[model samples]
Target: MAVPSGDQKPESYYVGVDVGTGSVRAALVDQRGTLVAFAEQPINQWEPQFNHHEQSSEDIWAACCVVTKKVVQGIDLNQIRGLGFDATCSLVVLDKQFRPLPVNHEGNSHQNIIMWLDHRAVSQVHRINETKHSVLQYVGGVMSVEMQAPKLLWLKENLRETCWDKAGHFFDLPDFLSWKATGVTARSLCSLVCKWTYLAEEGWDDSFWKKVGLEDLIADNYSKIGNQVLPPGASLGNGLTPEAAKDLGLPAGIAVAASLIDAHAGGLGVIGADVRGYGLACEEQPVTSRLAVICGTSSCHIGISKDPIFVSGVWGPYFSAMVPGFWLNEGGQSVTGKLIDHMVQGHAAFPELQAKATARCQSVYAYLNSHLDLIKKAQPVGFLTVDLHVWPDFHGNRSPLADLTLKGMVTGLKLSQDLDDLAILYLATIQAIAFGTRLIIEAMEAAGHSISTLFLCGGLSKNPLFVQMHADITGMPVVLSQEVESVLVGAAILGACASGDFSSVQEAMARMSKVGKVVFPRHEDKRYYDKKYQVFLKLVEHQKEYAAIMKGD
Candidate 1:
């Protein structure tokens, strides 16, 4: 998306900073959700070991400062009303003096953050699930290894001496950003309710904590974790502090909103977009009919309801997690864009494809899409993958199955190593991700969600192939937000709310987000997609069977 013209100015503006898996992006968004200016910076990520992803809080915050300063560069500082932050729901460690603490055994305090994708807590998550606690119901009957409770347990068990014992605060990355801005220790409901096992209606599940053996969290009245919570967009303790203001190149007393997990911010930006007159069935249905799929490196499918609807192996039913006064159910695919990149870049024909793509001034995937069209002849592009199938759980299945033990599987590999093969393989990976979304939708529908449309944003939504594949495979229309960087818009909405420019988040959502384009499902291709989906299911079943046989029972 292009930045807004310098000549056209809105009455007021909000600054949004989003820290995703690999980069930090900041935008200056006007009241209408147009990004006036934007800047981005890459942050550091380390693989201390396999499945053990680590990032430095210092590095992340520095990136945020750099981008923020750039976005607000020529704008009148007085016109900026508020600031908001959104980040991956990773764990941040700090000591009592509010200093970063080592999260790993190597004792490097700089790398105090455990990233959202880290799987070092697998054993802890399994043990937590084994308890069969009541709180599991809210998390779709099983907790994935990615949640904070399990990660905390892992720290206490394995890094007790270096990390856990000295730790005075455990902040979700979103909360960490807010605290840095306003010096407020309160956590966002989006982070606590969705990531930690905090119930909006009844506070922390002390019994669940005690049952999971992380009862030490209970000792300080949950101070180590968050004791006080605020809804996303609520004004935090006196807006940006003096030091933070100087660092971000913003005013000291501007409003600062409590933050949200990055994907939830994306949900807030797109889920409530005004879709009237779009001829979508969702236009006549309740907002709940729309599922906001935030597709980036990974993908999250967020559905909201007036009443709680429990979907097995999904994530929520958490109140006020994404949308206030609405119960949200989140289903997810752990790796969508990442899986596509892995498949494409690892192929033997990657070098040739890259050279051609660079010459055309297009991304490798874009060139691959063009190549598929060139080779498909009379059939659909998907037909290129008729003999090749990919089960895209290279990084364990995150939803519907909720099983991290599950491994990726592929069928139909050929001896041919050419551009045609690479293009088809790329198509298969995108199709596999779309299939994963279909599985998630099926699970949600079985649990009583009346979903009618999909609202999409983030990196993958920009790809026509990915968007069309999802629309065709899911048999639903995909609505693209007028603002491609809808997550930034969502973050800016938080700031708007906190600035009191909008009375409510719902109101801000309505006023800010707008539908740009709608991609309808191709019913003609439905028959073919249906047959492939069957193969997708059978592939998983056969994988489980293979595991059972390998056990030699």
Candidate 2:
């Protein structure tokens, strides 16, 4: 195992900063991986138009500063040995001196970041996919609008004068954070390989760029995007710069690890564990048999194999993208928790549900879970919405179809707008999302990958109903992480690696990440969900037919 040289004292504490869609969070983590203290501050976002989402890099960094200072408040500065970052795979636009540049028509540099959920690049993504370049093979044979290149293409064609012409650097959001801290221009393999179509073995595919009509990127040997790329755990240059050190309230020259996408960080936090007593069938199997579901605003299904497994519509088969020396195949739903929010908040019964939840001192979701039981009246919850079905592609399908043109669909709705209606619709949406997972699993299994377990983390995993629905629907045990904030711990594991406290990322994962509880599949509910899964598939199929008919095809 190759380790960093010139190790001095043992690592005492490391900080992990996560820049999620809604907020920036920092955790002060001990060497044992326990979160000692944490702080969070919500960042700003803008939607100047439809399908557009933007944020400020400067604002995100300021939030990072506030949270980092709070997390390390009472600790000795010297005890903070290293820091790491993980963020949504958003695009950050910058000019030559590393100043922010606008990514939208408003021309405000403060709104420079194009969030991962932004879909302004749909037309650009369609054009890139039309090229069908060989590089597309690494990205599930389709280019998602969420990825960087399509967004880059959009800048070139739409905002050429104001944004693209003056652009000097384009970064995946995580890389931008690392560069901010360390003054390094290097990119992480995790971001580039997974989102930017940079092959780990072959580097940039100039042909793909040229074919897609963005040949300018290759003109100077890919300098505008990135020329130097490092693996996720590798330490970046000279640690924290004096400016960043003062901003983060830390000592100068502390180690900074190359970062991962937030979902990948969640995967690192929960996927690998010694599952001897977990009552999971996968306990004795190889890690390849376990799938990591990092669920929150969006959900990514991360599966690894000793060799490449090319499941259609799933992004990856990328070498060493997540777990080193193994191949990663990531399937995802573009929206999950966000979808739940959209459905519940848009319902007429939302006010009533909110009032009742507040009266019970419970979350709306928690209140709904209990309400679901009452509505079921001794019947299985899955049977309550027997006639209603949902196709959870409201934010566009991310995997197993990779079709962005698809919209959300719901069937079997009545005229009533009561609380019961809201609860059942929420239940059906969660079930639809779970069925989407089952679809991805079926696709992977069809491609010869044997996955027997589901490992879950992130915000949605805290919901017992969501966890149980996944297990009951998939007929696989769902393992939860002991740490609620596994994504932060995963980022800290990167710091531990850079600090030389562990020999490898695998070692760090084993030591810091552990299983909390296992929700096993209920055999009794299996047949019921099996029938519902058939309806789930049919809903999507019928949706496509409706679109065809509407288009007069």
Candidate 3:
């Protein structure tokens, strides 16, 4: 990558930093949404105990600094117009004076972040769900253990002496990043409304908090969490603080946008792209016709509508959660990429497969896809998973069922532990994830969203097999963004909006997002996938039956 110089007429650019599950990735994206420079740095994650995931705010901030500096290495700092951040909606804790507060009883104060995936709040979530609070209806009728309310409750009950009692600020990670950048404590509506129980139209419900026994939040008027909220692209405070500017190696006072949840940032990046000339039905329809499926460590199916569309188990229909003036319904599969990694890495033939993949200079998944093609011969690769099926709830179902007790199940296993068996198992896992997406789409449509196409981004979208399987199984064309890291583009879109370079977020999205390619569903594979989906549904049915029988229900 060439260093962008100020020698020539300075060009407008935005810096987007994305904090993901396992790493911090930064991109220097031009106003046109092309990623000009990119860098990545891995962040630390600790499983101090099972189901309790924690990270350090200081460590994450350091990782963000590393990537942001690297991406801007050759760029003339003057050319950078704005900075934006998107991160996992993990909970970050700090003292009143703004010092890290330990989320765990024994861990260092640096380990203040309770990761979005942590399930320590399971009991708390169940109790909250039992309340049937009006807020529950906004969050798919069930408050997920993954969300902040339960996590906060868990802290109050279990870590009061160390954390909850002493804590002064509880931030969704995305908001924390913005506050880090601009020294602004206001939270983004994207985080507050989506993850916390802050309703976009009415703000927080005091009764719900008191009912859930976290009324301490109400006493402060929700200031510890967030009292003031702004939309995702709104400018924060005056801009980057001098201290943060020095840390990030960027100009002080550069426009810093109020950020978005990482997945929603991905949604903002690709969902608004001009899809004309793509020969897709979505081109002729309203933007509401397209669903943005941001698939990375997990997958979120976000679709926008003109009004609140109530899907029983799909979170949202929140106003302006992603796109302003649009009601966003977010459906999700809690673990897709992670589950794939678990299955592929845990198999008995994994060692053999790894060696073969390395010799071919390919990712294990790519190599496995090629091997499936080679073995399937004239038959379609999808046929290889005919006897095998996977239920991918290793992290529990996030949508369309809202059930957390569901465990992963695999049917049709032979005694043999061969490479072929491993490849087929990998294929089965991918198909199952696609089936999950299909279920989510059905739920969304049944509620009111007329989704005609899927706009895909995130790491999984790079896999041809994954993209094709989604297209084939969902029977919708998958549109790929010209900028493969659309989440970064989405983050940059926030910067563009903050800079006032565009009138609204919608304009920025239209100008920056571009269609790179389209994968059309293979109609010939329809019957096969339909049958597989039926079997996929049955697998979960049997899982529930088995659970009932064991419980003597």
TM-score of each: 0.98, 0.97, 0.98
Off by over 4 Å in 2: 1-11
Per-residue lDDT for 1-553 in model 3, tens only?
4454667656799999999998999999998999999999999998899988999999999999999999899777888899999999999999989999998878588899999999999999999999999999999888888999999999999988898888899999999999999889999999999999899999999999999999999876788999999998999889999999999999999999999999999999999998888799988999999999999999999999888888999998699988899999999988998899999999999999999999989999899989999999998899898889999999899999989889899999999999999999999999999999999999888888899999999999999999999999999999999999999999999999999999999999999999999999999999999999999999999999998899994
Candidate 2 accuracy as TM-score: 0.97
Q: Candidate 1 lDDT, tens digit per residue, 1-553?
A: 2334788754699999999998999999988888889888999999889999999888999999999999998777889999999999999999889899988888889999999899999889999999999999999999989999999999999889888988999999999999999999999999999999899999998899999998889887899998999999999998999999999999998999999999999999998888888889999999999999999989999999999999999998899987889999999998988888888999999999999999999999789989889999999887778878889999899999999988888799989999988888899989999999999999999999999999999889999999999999999999999989999999999999999999999999999898999999999999999999999999999999999999995
Arrange candidates by lDDT, highest first: which order?
Answer: 3, 1, 2
Instruction: Write out the backbone clash pairs for model 3.
Output: none
lDDT of 1 at 500: 99
Predicted model with the maximum lDDT: 3
RMSD of each: 2.1, 3.4, 1.5
Please report the TM-score between candidate 3 and the true structure. 0.98
The 0-to-1 C-alpha lDDT of every candidate, in the order given, reads 0.92, 0.91, 0.93
Provide the clash count, candidate 2: 0
- 1 or 3, greater by TM-score: 3
Better of 2 and 3 by lDDT: 3
TM-score comparison, 2 vs 3, better candidate:
3
TM-score leader: 3
